[model samples]
Target: MAETNDILEVAKMTISTSIKCNTVRGFIGWHSCDNICMDMHDVLDMCEDAFKRERYQESLEADTYVLVSGVKLASCADSSSGMLTDVIMRAFELIDLSTQTIAKLDAAMRKHALSLIIKEAKKKAFDGWDSWRYELLEKAVCLCDEKLAAKLEKLLDIFLEDIENDYMPEYKRQEDTILRYKLHRHLKGADAVKDELYANLYIREMCIIAVKDATDARNYNEAEKLCLEQIKKEDGRFYRNTPEDWNNILFDVYMQSGITDKQIEQAKKILLLGNEGFWDVLKRLYQSQGIWESQKPILLKELKQCKYSVCYRSVLVKENEKKLLLEAVTENPYNLFYYAQFLVMDYPNEIYELCANYIREQCAQATDRRLYKKVCKDLLQLIKWKGNATAKLLVDEFKATYPRRSALLDELQKVEKKL
Candidate 1:
């Protein structure tokens, strides 16, 4: 961990310095898998340098990664003049792109020697509708084709006017759903080319919109039907929209359409399939039936499948809840934070054991003081929650176990007085 931290720290410093001064060689050699997203700001901050050095290809790649690396940025389809503009301008300079390419035959003679870069890009397979490169090229082409640009701008205006005048409210919502469907299909298209565009965000958005629309219209049956239709359509998917989106919408459908024992049980079975954020609704479903205790085991299983222990956040560590916390801790002692923090007052002994046991495990395995310092502070908080001399046991164990860690002891002492 220290080595990893050191490498990242050094990389940040080197990248930052390179950005401060135009150092193309420093950038060309330093960037790789490890340092790609080390700091996007750092990577993007180097665009001007690459562009200045006439490394037009390198400039375009950097701009692409920073601009469209995720769904949130890619879905915008807006952003008129940002990093994309900066890189495209440089590409145009290198290629000497101008309206002459379209209108004046003599203007072709003004092409830069580096115009071959655009020539190579034009050979690559990409859709103008979906490709960021195509979007950039369209903007660059506008600079040279003033008449075409005006027509394109006018068409865009007409399209916006059509949308605005279409429904004002009802059609607007339908357009929202249409946008989500567009994204859902686009993600499928991206999958064909092996691109990673979080299709789930759009899928989930569609489900949420349908639910909202149906509820507002006081048409639960229609909402339920819509949700089921979507779930059927999204039965198989790319890697993005899974457990959370479907479970949330499905749960909503079941509840609004009259949640039955059969439906709740089916939802439980569906949740067991693997999910992320629908635990709350699942819990609500269980509680509605007054069967929460019997259903916790299933909920825990679903939470384990997720990346967080937050599924059990509403559960308290009592007689009935002890096993849940213990199971959570066994999965990740860090889970102790999620449940044990709540246990601090009523379940001090359990909190003490959890803190001491995890701290011991951590002390044995922890080599880096920098990382351990955080654990140490967190342990101190757990110990202080004891608010009695039992806290001393954890303090002594910590001090004796990791004697070299004066920082840990200092943190313990800082809170010891408060306790």
Candidate 2:
């Protein structure tokens, strides 16, 4: 019974050795079958008793058979099927093994066993799904093999089509949080993965990105299209609130698209929105359209209503005889002197006479030398018209206020002679 136990123990050890050898050969065969013979030769040199023993010889034979079989399996791999097979083969070849036992194996049996092992490996690889299938497909395209590259291209198109049509709609919502999530998932790189999937997913974000890309590429038509789409979506909400943002973007799109009139119209709409800050933007837009003459009245109106002294002064100095200046002086006589001076250069005798009458009326309430000078100047210019007697009354009133200045009185007397 002891002897029987000893024999069973040896049998178990032999089977264990055989299994180890088989596993190593199968691994190496799949990974580097061309180098299998050399690898096995090196493994055989390390085994002591196994090299001499017939049991060791059997194990070596099994391993060689598995290795050869694995090689044949690897030979059948195409780009789609090769990735997993390559990984399995590499794992096998890289493991530790007894060299001596490998050497004693019959070369022919080893080759056949390797083939059987590889055939089994090919079966396993074919049966299971590889996690890196997409990655493999990508790599295959760079291989410069036209057939494989074309296949990968088709596969990517189908895969992307499936992704777009199948699962992209779940991301569409007015909520920022959900839109951000969709953007994060769908946009992987500069390729715009979502472009193919949905016509308008995270539309605002899409429009912004498309506009930026198109602009960078100098594709003004595409940029304009995206910007217009954004405007259409804005639907007056932009006009009511973020008018500047809307107008600024629209201005850029129109300018880039060579649509000067559209840009000016958008600017006018912005000005009508009544945010005084938008005037500068409107000015720029108007200048871009070469329509500053048309925009002058709008700017002057804004200046007339403006309470800021600096805003009023700035506009008055820049535009000397703008119609709003006349209107402003007529409505608010505090600026009458400035308006009178501006009109001297801009208006002729008849308009000047009207301005003088307005000035005389305002001065009747509170007389100042500036107003007196404006009225006297208009009356002297319009002395031949029937309005000269009214100018004489104003000069008599000025004389009463400043009787000491006879030189000015002498000038008024000379003016009556001209009338």
Candidate 3:
């Protein structure tokens, strides 16, 4: 039993040391082989168990052996082998390998390792391998000594050359090639390249980019020139004949260029052709010109163009056309609530008869407490304001419609009592 235990201890040590050495050499060996070959999991378990047992020396030996064995395998493996050979080799240099052992590594071995890494990187790039390429580049950059970083930068230039020579024209298969080039130029910090790219681009896209770039650069004169050129190239019938398009561009140019009020007036005359939608733009322009009174007639015309029921109801109240406002309220008697309010402030006598008629019609239709309360409130206010002859009739209608709402009826009754 003692002899068996002694052999087991020695065998464990040898296995541990071998694993450490292999791991340092950057290779993951086969899972199953002859007795001399270790399973990856068995090696890992032995290392872990040794640590758990507080066998520190044995653990260290195991780790070193794994590292060295891994390195030896890596040295012989193909470039495309998916192990981290380069990292492992660098780590070996940092380990406590004897100077003689380190010196024993041939120049060809070091060169072959580096070549494998580069070859793997190129292969990854060719395979359209995004994940591995980025990972490999990052790892390579990290491992590079200061001297190697400079060399790596040169290598990057070569990679970019490869990309340009082989990939660029093929990659830009779309009609938006000029736009793509402009974008790429901006990213690359190549202003001269961008300018050259812009020169060959489609005229419309070129004009747009030039104007945008100039505006962004605060070159106002250049931006103005580009904008004018763009405007000239636009189909005149579309831009000049359409008030909306003309006004939009004119306003942008006017605002951006800080044109004088007189210049703006001229631009507006050229742009606005009295289209119904131009009412808002005219109002804004006239307001800017401090000519609000001149915009009132246009506002009335706009109110007349509101053919939709919701729009007609909404705008008629605020419009300058008293005739339209009165007509709309007469057509939809509920609109009299708004008309009554407007008349109270604006045309007291003219709306007195209209308000009285509205109250009579609303009371006849008031079938619910809510509707009755609404009519009652408006009727009482109109009656109080004008003391029209129908005030007594409105009071009677309120009482008849909302008998259950006696408190509200009493409120209306109080108004009659006050009168």
- Estimated TM-score for each candidate: 0.39, 0.29, 0.34
Regions of candidate 1 where Cα sits further than 4 Å from its true position: 1-262, 273-323, 330-332, 367-369, 387-391, 397-419
Could you arrange the candidates by TM-score from highest to lowest? 1, 3, 2
By lDDT: ranked, best first: 3, 1, 2
lDDT values, one for every candidate: 0.48, 0.47, 0.49
Better of 1 and 3 by TM-score: 1
Q: Candidate 3 on 155-234: residue-level lDDT in tens?
A: 54555555545444343222224333443453354466656655653444455556556666766677666655555666
Please state the error at residue 106 of candidate 2 in Å: 49
Which residue window of length 10 is worst by lDDT in model 3? 94-103
lDDT of 2 at 385: 43
Best by lDDT: 3
Per residue, candidate 2 scores C-alpha lDDT tens digits across 1-419 of: 12322332443354345335544524533333334333333333222224244443333333333333334334442323354344334323321132223323555443443333333333434222222222222222212233333433453344334443533323312222223323333334445554532455334555565676677777877777766766666675554355236456666667666666676676556555544454676677677668878867766666555454434544555555456555555566565444556554564454555556664575455345555455556566555444566566667676786686555565567667766
Give per-residue lDDT, candidate 3, residue 325. Answer: 69
Which one is best on TM-score?
1
